[model samples]
Target: MDFEKLLVWQRAKALTVSVYKEMAACPDLVFKSQITRSALSIPSNIAEGMERFTARDKCRFLRIAKASCGELRTQLMIGSEIAYVAEPLAAVWIIETRELSKMLNGLINRISD
Candidate 1:
């Protein structure tokens, strides 16, 4: 299966772009870099896994992507708590990222089984 064509990959790519745009607006370099990297990891891992030769390898990467999604969600929560991010904006990102994580987990489970 082509990772480029996967819905998980598409959502993750969009999330990464959104993270970059959001981070660009922030004044703090530390949080910006961290969040952006976490966001990028979601899709990057999926793409890297897709290039692997086995379904097991793909599942491993998908799990990593899901973990990154969780990490991104936590960062968003922290950003909102500290006022680095607006509540509504963080809410939107959290919802999307959480949903994507769930989707990735499902895919991984199905493939592994």
Candidate 2:
């Protein structure tokens, strides 16, 4: 199966792009870098896991991706609360992250079974 064709991966790629754009002008370099990396991790982990030869390895990476989703959600919330991220954008991102997490859970279960 090709990871690129995955809906979750596609959404993750979009999320990563959105995050990069959102943080392009952020004065807090550290925050911007961290969030973007977390955003990037979603799709990267998905692809890496999909490419793996074993179910165990795939699940491991998927779990990592799911964890990264939690990290990203927290960062986005903090960014929104601090007014660093616009409310509307943050809202969409938060929704997307949650959805991605759900999708990842489903994928992980499907793979493990």
> What is candidate 1's local distance difference test score?
0.92
Residue 27, candidate 2: alpha-carbon lDDT? 99
The collision pairs in model 1 are none
Each prediction's TM-score against the native?
A: 0.96, 0.98
lDDT of each: 0.92, 0.96
Candidate 1, 19-112: lDDT as tens digits: 8987898899999999999999999999998888988898889889999999999999999999998899999999999899889988888888
Using lDDT, give the best candidate's number.
2
Misplaced by over 4 Å in model 2 are none
Among these predictions, the greatest TM-score belongs to 2
Q: Estimate the TM-score for candidate 1.
A: 0.96
Q: Which ten residues in a row have the lowest lDDT in candidate 1?
A: 18-27
Give the per-residue lDDT digits (tens) of candidate 2, residues 29-110.
9999999999999999999999999999999999999999999999999999999999899999999999999999999999
